[model samples]
Target: MPVRKLLSGLIGGMTPAGRFRHACRLLERADHSVRGFARLGQMAGSGMVAAQYQVACAYLDGIGVPRSPLEGMRWMHRAASAGHVEACFSLALMLLVDPPGQDGADSLLPTAWPEGIDAWPDPVAATHWAGQAARAGLPDAQALYGYLLATGPESVRDPEAAGIWCARAAQAGCPQGDLALAVNHLCAPDQPPGSNPGAVAALLRAAESGLPTAQYMLGLLHERGWGLSPDAAEAEKWYARAAAGGVRPAQARYGVMLLRNGRGNSRAIMAAETWLRRAALAGDREAAALLGDLHACGKAALPGDHEAVTWYRMAAEHDHAVACRMLALLYIQGRGVASDPDQARDWLQRAAVLGDVAAMTDLAATLLDRRDTPPATPAQAAAPLPDFRAMAQAGDPVAAFNLAVSLHRGVGCAADPAQAAMWMERAAEAGVVNAQYWYGRMLLAGEGISASPSQARHWLERAASHGLPEACIAAAQARLEGYGGPRDHAGALAFYHRAAEAGRGEAMFSLGAMYGGGHDVPPDRTQALHWFTRGAQAGNALAQFMLGRYLAQGLAGPVDRAQARHWLAQAVAGGVTAASAELDGMMLADDHAAP
Candidate 1:
């Protein structure tokens, strides 16, 4: 392990031309046995970790070797054991695929390394490898490792460890690690105060000190407050600095931000898009991911083009989790592309493999929905459906909620209300607003746990804190009804106001009615009319009808017969029967006077 001998070992490894020839030869031997890689896998000390990874991949995936996942796995570990960074990444990925303990063997996970392998699933697997590689100076691995250590659950991740790696990487002139590390820490709510400020300072310092990746990250941070206070001005400043450094990503990001926020020196929206396209071609995942989204969503800014899926597919090919989710969603929804349920499942599986919770939830939902769409038989339902509970246990909020629902109601599985309560509790604690609502309901009713109204109120308050408009409305309703809690009209109005601000049409209309009727809050005809008008403009049909009534009856606002008729027409169009009946009666009266 001495530096001189290690360097000598590396120098004595394959020559540049020899490594190239070896890689090329791998193409011609695509059908060879993976076991042969053990003999051919020897890389000179000069062979970089990435190059060794290519060899490990060939052995594990049958890319250029005979199909033998076991041999491939063994070879990958050998390289990993030798402290190769990419090999460590592959090993970590394998571990995630086959979580070490208590994961049922049937989970289709990677077989744990057999006896004789020197390495095991170390808690800091990803970081350990990255640290070694980073210390020797590898930018991508440093950034990746720092990010993993900073954000992954404590079951695997470590912020202090992440900080150490980030500092080393930053000192060694790897700017991307600084920005990515900042984001990693920023994503964790439990971090000590000033964690983000310190991380952002490091990123800014690195960016200003001339690391292109840092500059790009600083631009993003200032753009979205990724780990720092959002300041559009500062974003543009860092972006300009990065652009001056010839970072294609910075130019594209800066252009896009200008276009999005309508700031100074605007790139023609299309021009900005063109810069993103350029960055995408240059292999920027962020650019490719953004372009894919733009193409998929087609706005006045980025026209909806199925071709965006193509770009997304390309980016996803390189293991971009967001791109993977995007592609899976498209395939599942059949949007701007042929619908392929199977392909959607495949992409979702891949995305989940890359640790995408959204993809995992969608996949579980797809299976559940597919069963409903096609109507699986009772026997089929009895059979173990895909273990979506794994995803919930793994920290997918939606999945956690759905898992609770399934257990509570016995959908495609047996009913287990007690278990359902446990899952719901987890989802609620994790901040799924709907789950919070349900968990509160369960607590209030003692569905599984013992009755605890105080706990129920706590959960409801948390849901309200998240501004789930529906939950706020429901909680307000509960409070007003004095169900499991004391009545507080003032508090109810506060929640209704929150729901109204969040654009709950029903809540908005109700707020208007309460104001008009002097219920909940003091009656203010003017405020009622204003609220009704605002709600109607926001396309709330009920509000439209109520506002029309106010005008026609001269209740809350000055009568405007013509405006009343117009809003009445709108309400009728929305299938408001009372409005239709009123209009019919009015027209009949008008006809009676027509002569």
Candidate 2:
């Protein structure tokens, strides 16, 4: 007879307790049959602990029934409450992994649940059940309980107790127990040097058992030489294994190692790129930055600049300071994208805000030369001044120069010439070329500091050596006027010529005057007229006036009254009063000649 039929006949004459015992026997004898499962369910409903545990297992594992977590947890809780050891461990494990507020049978546990506690992990409840199973000599439960005690909430943490439980589990050959021991050892503080013997041994054992996290930790130990001689090859081997097992940090470290060891090898570069891209996509900023560098520099025959920009932008968006600056450089240089000063400035500012000192200096230089920048609203204009001042105070030379200019011109603050001179001199001493020129001018004019012709000439020459056009012109004037040293007309002419070739309108006018007046050279009216014409076309008011006068008198070449009038009108529009008076004289001459 089938076990279910035999049990049915035997239980009819028996008492209630005898019938219950017969039901348990039938459940065990009928094993995996559908009829046995049906009887087991009935017995579980009637408060049989073993039957409830078996029914829970069936629902959880989808054995001869439709799997349902709600039914599984309900029955598991019933068995666990009735002191089934395996049932208690199963319930704890389920509760430990379930997301907070989503535990299937939470409402059946307690009535005094704390309000607003859904955000916190309910490890304490899981620990309660795991403790009973752990004390019952379940190795897995011992390891879990020890880990929870070691790493759970402050109220339940007891490292000494955790160590004892983990030692027992480890002796029973549980891999997780070894991993827990390693974690505790690594996290211990104030350990004596060379004291990580247990951690290294435990990590090696766990890693050899194919644990990905243990493999990564073992790699770190080898790389850092924590408890052994540093071994790059050993570290690489472990990291490679962990990376293959999908450990993200291991992927990043493995890629970096491959890149370092395989420089100039195309196969190595490609392999490294694959792992780095994986880690970068998983939100590793360091990995993203390394990927950007590889592609940006055309490593492994990759399309360089465009791909670099893509990776750099990814890292930069996450506030990687170096990536932000590199992206800014790419934009400014038009590498793999159209040159956009605005985008470049935006990234540079972001990098500076992230405490990149080099970015702060570069940003200040870019802002100081925005003569053609699109107009911004008042709010946009005023927003960066405070930050600019801070950068200046933090010892950025270009920032100091920009702040001085801002103070002198009253762009974002009151005009303070004294402060401007002070900052300009500081920046000049710091080797800022523009600052050298401006500070020299301030000293020459005594605008905010005592006039010192000697110091002025020295700074002007310093700037002139760097080929600054304005500085050349200022240095020439100092030589011609004997402000600092003996007058040297030859030196003055040379400086004027240098500035004129660099397209300084003021320098062109000066050269024209020197040639026309025969200053330290033979008179050359033709050369004078040539420079004056070039200067006039370059929008120099004095050059326009001189060119008009020369045209009217025919001093350099043939006279042209119409051309003279045109030049005179241009000069007058440029605010040269002498040109207006000359135009009046020409009108009188025309009237006299017509009559």
Candidate 3:
């Protein structure tokens, strides 16, 4: 039997109350017919607010009547105008509700309206209806009215008025009202310190009512010791509760705390991973990047490069700069994927565009290499380059260094050594060790800057202390030549040894010259020959020339004409002017000795 018929038959000959009850029962049925609801609506009379509200709900949701929000809202407006409290509140809620796909505070106000309608869910209409409901003592309406007053259309944002309504709603047991009151007291920059007590009380009330955002805020307060003693344990407990309630930021914080402080507890580690994954899936980019790092580094029980790549890609697609840079490195090293320089460069470019300083530096180096040897694809050739001056001004040290290099070398830019020196100095001050060495060299050479031997040595020593081999060698030469300070052969020899140990070919050659000339210590022909051989093998053309001449004349050891010719030829290929003359002399000698 149809629900409407059954309900009508059962209620036949009953009292008026019974008829109304039966009508409501019929409307409540999931399969109730639209025509039957329309008949019941007529019988209930225009003055019956409950019946009108039910019919409006049915129309709005398409429960029995045809889905017509416009008609539903009209009926609701009629009931509300007749002083039905719930009808007023419901109308306000429908008007103020956010459109789908947006969530929480970021949700956009509804804009849809029925065909031929001028406006529906209008902010002004919502505020008017909400005000009526609030005046009727509805806590939810009071809270909503307060929020709308503070954050509605530009003309309606009255903070003082919002505070009054919010206080009334909170006193009447509205959780949202309590939250608003707490935020007003805590977050308003103009609020006095006296408001902290009220903010904490309001937050406590909301948290006790099981509001997740309130719990998260309380956790932050406890963790930061804001108006309370710092308590990590209490903070973690609140964070855990918030995370369980599906708060994304709370989930991330709780997961990170657990992972950092788990102390090898497998249960804590597992729980942390679960919460982090939940947060990551909920579109928390930082959580996704953290998960990627954990998996990449085999932490929190996640130990797979492929899994790391998946997480990094998720964050990277969301425009996470660090995650993109990490993905680039992984691709370049073939750690979790095939080594593809193109893919690596692509990811690096993405990260650089997202303002990753390290990525910008790496991308610049790659572009410079590509300039020397053209890239295979036009896309690679046309990849957008970062504005070095802009990035440098934005405090990227590597960008300052790169800009300096471009200016100094006139690579795609006008040569301006003065500007280059200025940029190099900026990079050096910003802690680029290589830039410090270069700036020191510029100072020593008076290259677009006044020569200051003392300043040159100062910067060189600083860079050397930071383990820059080239800076160490330069500092050693400065000491040996007494260019900046008093000559100290012993100090120079010590620096030379340090640089040589760090594989500086120039330092090795200097060591050989010191021993061969007996300038620093007593001459040692054996040590000189050993140092020259090592420097030559390390590609020092001057060392190769010296070694070849020494070997040919038997200066350090037994003469070996074959080795001398070989070293001289290698030195000539290395662009040593004296090596070329020596090789020619050997060729002439060979010709003279020929039969």
Candidate 4:
């Protein structure tokens, strides 16, 4: 039944156990002639226990009732104290979950009731109640105590004790305990490493007994080549049984498997998608992320979907890091949305706050360049200061390094080289690569810390070891020039290659110069032109000048006058004085040629 209808039945002046018994009688035609309300109204202790459990459900759901888990637990306690089998089962399930607060104190129940008042759920109390239920042929309580003994989590598992309880429950037709033993055998099977034949036999018996979990495990065993020969069709059959019993993961697996059987089923992806959505809705975090990715990529035919975005947004709201980063990027690039730099920065900040290192880096960059310029004021306009220091202090390594940069450069905050060095030191220690490079700089120059070339080289080496391009470039330059150590041109070349791939404009220009002049590398004007053109387009002034020279001399690719003039103009604009002079000379020559 829908939970709403169940709640209404309770609120309409019907007792829980009475209603259950009535429903069972009506369904089964067991012909119990007890007057429903009269019997309940005249009921003694045992009868009230049913009403208490029903009222507990009403309180728990708040559908035609007031939502109150604590109240539910209280009533559950009442029924449990009366030696109710269902109440004991409910109590066991509730205890397995988080405890509800009681009497204004943070705990589940008031230290147990019914079994042993002063010693509730203690070894003795749990054993006594569980023993009574086990002997009385109750299934779930037997399953619980059997599990405790079988796993030995709180106490040692007496296999003999476990066997006795499991046998009783199995005889009572409780599939769960049998399934539990089956699972225990599957995981540890042999007492040590290899497969346990005894455990496999136990699982097969449990599967035959209609235990859904066992069926699923048996499906996994067949799906893999474990104990059984690998068989997709056989696995699907077991999975179907588990799904029929309402196991969420099994439902998903079975649905996807049926979908994949393409002889008649071409809707495998769709079926998988539906099951994934169901799992996501049922509070599976990984399912939410997977569904979001499918939607985002259109693999689920959900193109241009904010449905995935909404899922991600919901997950992010619930504090998922990957979801936070996804939202952060959407805001950062203004993808299919209005660009709001502050909102972008805020999202990035949230991701950083959640300890995402990449998000921290992006957040630091955004904070340092906040486009939060309120329209040019008629009064003095104070510069927008980056506030990533707070996050840095909160232990974000990237934020720490960024805060240090702001302090060192006075970009968005006051210049305090000392503080900058301190934060940079912290960030470097925390494993941020660039922080190591900058930390080295501070040590070398005595800009923030005491000057020590050796310490500078040490930190630079650390950064370089991690393949930090900028650090590599700087370290290679220092080494090749014999500033901190002996010249190593080979190291310089390797560093240049690393920096160039990372899109460093100056490194590309330097590589082109090396190739063009054949100073250290073999002369190759074709390669030089390629690097020079790439660097020039990226706004490197020297590269622009070099590209213009190559075009004028026809030393690399054939170039038209239009291309040469464009590069010359760019070089001049970038403050290359020689390019400016050459532009004037070329203009004079062009005028002379025209005359």
Best candidate according to TM-score: 3
Give each model's clash number.
8, 0, 0, 1
Q: Over the stretch 444-496, how does candidate 1's per-residue lDDT look in tens digits? A: 88998887877887788777754556567777877777766787777887887
Per-model TM against the reference:
0.41, 0.53, 0.56, 0.46
The C-alpha RMSD of each candidate to the native structure, in angstroms, is 20.2, 15.9, 15.2, 17.2
Q: Candidate 4 clash total?
A: 1
Residue pairs clashing, model 1 = 10-45, 10-46, 13-44, 13-45, 14-44, 32-66, 60-72, 298-304
TM-score of 2: 0.53
lDDT, each prediction: 0.70, 0.81, 0.80, 0.68
lDDT by residue (1-595, candidate 2, tens digit) is: 8998996687677875565565555545536445557877887898878889988887776566766666777788789888898988887787777532354544433233333223223678778778888999998898888887888777878889988888888889988888877776666565642367876787788899998988998888888887878999999999999999999999999999998899778888889989999999988888998888877665744746678888999999999998998888666645556456789889998999999977876675566557346546665566464445787788878778888887777766788999999999989999877789999999999978999999999999888765567788889999998988889888988888767765677888998998998577667889899999999998899999999999999999999999999999999999999899999999999999995
Candidate number with the higher lDDT (2 or 3): 2
What is the descending lDDT order?
2, 3, 1, 4
For residue 331, give model 1's deviation from the true position in Å: 18
Candidate 4 regions off by >4 Å?
A: 1-34, 45-87, 94-131, 148-164, 171-173, 186-194, 223-230, 252-266, 317-320, 335-595
Of the two candidates 1 and 2, the one with more favorable lDDT, higher being better, is 2
